[model samples]
Target: MRRLLWLTAAALLAAGCSAAPGGEAAADKQPAPRPLGGVLHHTAAEAAALHRAEEREVRECMASRGFEYSAVPVGDGVRRRAAGNPYGLLTRAVAAQDGYGLTVERLQRHPADPNAQRVSALAEGDRRGWEAALKGTRDGPREEIELPDGPTVSVPTDACATVARRALYGASWDRDRYTVHSLADTIVRETLGHTLVRAAEREWAACMRDEGYRYEHRKDPLEELEKRLDTAGSDPAALRTNGREELRIAVRDAACQVEAGLAEQVSRAQEQVEKALPPARTSRLEEFRAAREGALRRAGARAASTT
Candidate 1:
């Protein structure tokens, strides 16, 4: 069955960056922006503000449509609970302990969801209607978005969530809205293609070979580990064996990343990529940033009013 929009496992991570589930801000003051590689990221406070504003808009829209919608507030611990670097840029010591960090992710406990409880309490027919209201009819109008590195996905155009997203970001937002949240593979592609970065990567590969691991690309280690893990599923003995091997490979991979200067070169390549972005792409990114800031302001105002 099509689950309710913004419910399920996603709620644990989506519920908060700095605010609890209601319209209230978790922190009184907004936090500064964070950096991802060279890109600017919203601080937890800013994320919570935007989420608080978006969810409130969703709730109001649902109420107008004669449905009960609960606003899932961003909890301060949402992203904080997850351990390990998603990018796999681990230090030698940490890598020796956590491996590709997938083990920690596998064992991470999920938080409770009020929305799930709400949905569970509803009649089957009512649940379907509720999902359709919040997420739109399955066969309804959808806007197709092409991700930089992923398959195209269709987003409901007229759902309460869509309405809220447009209200917060801008009616003109579609692709830009996706770029704000999804991976921008465009930059990664360009960065990796840089002559210097490629050379550094070759060196990293050689370093790996020297350490008794042969991989042509940086992602190979995790991909290989994941296949072994898939085969080891639900088998304690196999998992333990794999886990031990993973730590050894991870430690070497991480040390090689630093020793080969791949990390440094990638940083340099990213800076170059950021500077050399085509005017059109640069314009789009700037527009997205403006939309983000505009929503943050609205969120701030919304939080202030509730207080």
Candidate 2:
């Protein structure tokens, strides 16, 4: 999927550059911002609702096949799994305390689903059959959907995931929007890799050094903390020490970012990319929004009907 999207973006940029004035050099100079908070095909609430509807379908599908199942509510944990500072703006409060949230334990741990445990207790052959029914075969037949002027992507149609998606988004909805969202993500990644952003990162690194920390990039502090945690292993004392050092470094990193104006520079570059996207890409974005809204409405209706 990643390779295909990159190829699509590359093709679009190549075509766009040849037709535009000054070619690739001028196009590279243009500012392109990645979507703020990442490209969400569905909002958290919408996704959660869709998941609930899907879970219900899975339960019914299993029961009809002579197996019991339970529907679990997809709540905060599922929705906020990818929550992070996508905009490069880290608040002082967040940095001073959480420090990338490596040390902080999750407050809402997901309890084991009883239905899964019940499934596990079944006879080996029956359990395998139930699992296959719910998840479909790993090497099963697949349905391929192609993007407009892009590569074709395949997905399993005989799984619970597909059932839920079809109920909420209708057939081919995933394929239609996949390219649009993936292309937007590629633009953001390219924007971050811009020379101007790299220069700003150097300035940020310099500020971190002045604060008595040697780091090359904005993500270095968290990366260092992750390494330390891995080395600490099961040692509580070492973990605590590492956690404290991480908080201190994180606070300094956020302060340095402000002093060096790194966030502002990155944001500016992103805005340029957002403004410079070709009309076709922009149209796809609009289509993405409409598809999302329509899916949400359909998902809501399905959920309400089940109740």
Candidate 3:
């Protein structure tokens, strides 16, 4: 969803130069502002809780229709690790430790969700029916549901997925709240593309070049590392070798970001956008936050009752 209003603690620390050793504060560094906290957005934990609630509803809905279903628990470790680096900030300390997180090896070992595997193991005819029931009609004319706002959203009304969402988010959930959240996030990203931020990115790229790495943007180093990881796949020796290389590159990348002041520049740009946002946009953000909180509360209560 759109996530413009908050910066993770890691992002905040990195941007403020508080997380890195020997990092100098830029002369024009704006005052680092704290994020709006729980009021402005849902935490990763809250999102995962809501997802689990939805899965539970889907499983129950399928069971009531005489099909077996399972609610696969979400991986807390993955969520925690991802939230820690939401903006892909690769500090020297983090690089020395994780090195792109063994994502490729983990995925190779567990290619499909356990719940999905259970569904797939059913007889072909039964599987077809279960899939159709869960996902709605496969070959029907598409339909659109309009939200209270002036926007139309599409969903498969005939699918069990729709039922799951309705159960968790109420019958009137048209995803308008999420749409607004997405818009706010887009504003931050677009602001980062402004001239001043782009100049900082160029300087960061040059710094990386001097360190013997060819990268154009702050995200490029991680992206390239991921590609290498994917190529290494499940081979233990290859993974270890590639992972070490990734750590070295990531450490250099983080150093360059600090040296070129990219984090500070991006943070300032984001702050400017947040301050200059129009009243209408701000109103939508509040609405989104309220809706998210209500959904999470309901989901948590439902989960508690079921247990």
The number of the candidate with the highest lDDT is 1
Candidate 3 lDDT, tens digit per residue, 129-161? 888888877474335754333467667766767
Runs of candidate 2 with Cα error greater than 4 angstroms are 1-47, 64-66, 73-83, 105-113, 145-153, 275-283, 298-307
Ranking by TM-score: 2, 3, 1
The segments of candidate 3 whose C-alpha lies over 4 angstroms from its true place after superposition are 1-44, 84-88, 92-94, 101-108, 115-118, 121-124, 139-153, 172-174, 181-185, 230-233, 274-283
TM values, all candidates: 0.68, 0.72, 0.71
Arrange candidates, best lDDT first. Answer: 1, 2, 3
lDDT by residue (1-307, candidate 2, tens digit) is: 3233223333433442244334323323433223733446345676687777767777777777676788876654543333344545554445544556665432234656767778878999998888877777878867887665557878777766576666666665666567676666666676688776788889889988988888887777777878887888756567666666765676566656666666667777777777777776555565566666777777789878868
lDDT over C-alpha atoms for residue 217 of model 2: 77
User: Which runs in model 1 stand beyond 4 Å of their true positions?
Assistant: 1-53, 71-88, 91-98, 111-113, 120-125, 138-154, 179-183, 235-245, 272-276, 300-307
RMSD values, in order shown: 10.5, 13.0, 7.7
Worst 10 residues of 3 by lDDT: 1-10
Clashing residue pairs for model 1? 15-74, 15-75, 16-74, 16-75, 19-74, 21-73
lDDT of 3: 0.61
Error of 1 at 169 (Å): 2.9
Mind sharing the TM-score for model 3? 0.71
| Candidate 3 clashes between residue pairs 3 or more apart in a chain or in different chains | 2-181, 2-182, 136-159
Per-model tally of clashing residue pairs: 6, 5, 3
Q: Candidate 1, which ten residues in sequence have the lowest lDDT sum?
A: 26-35
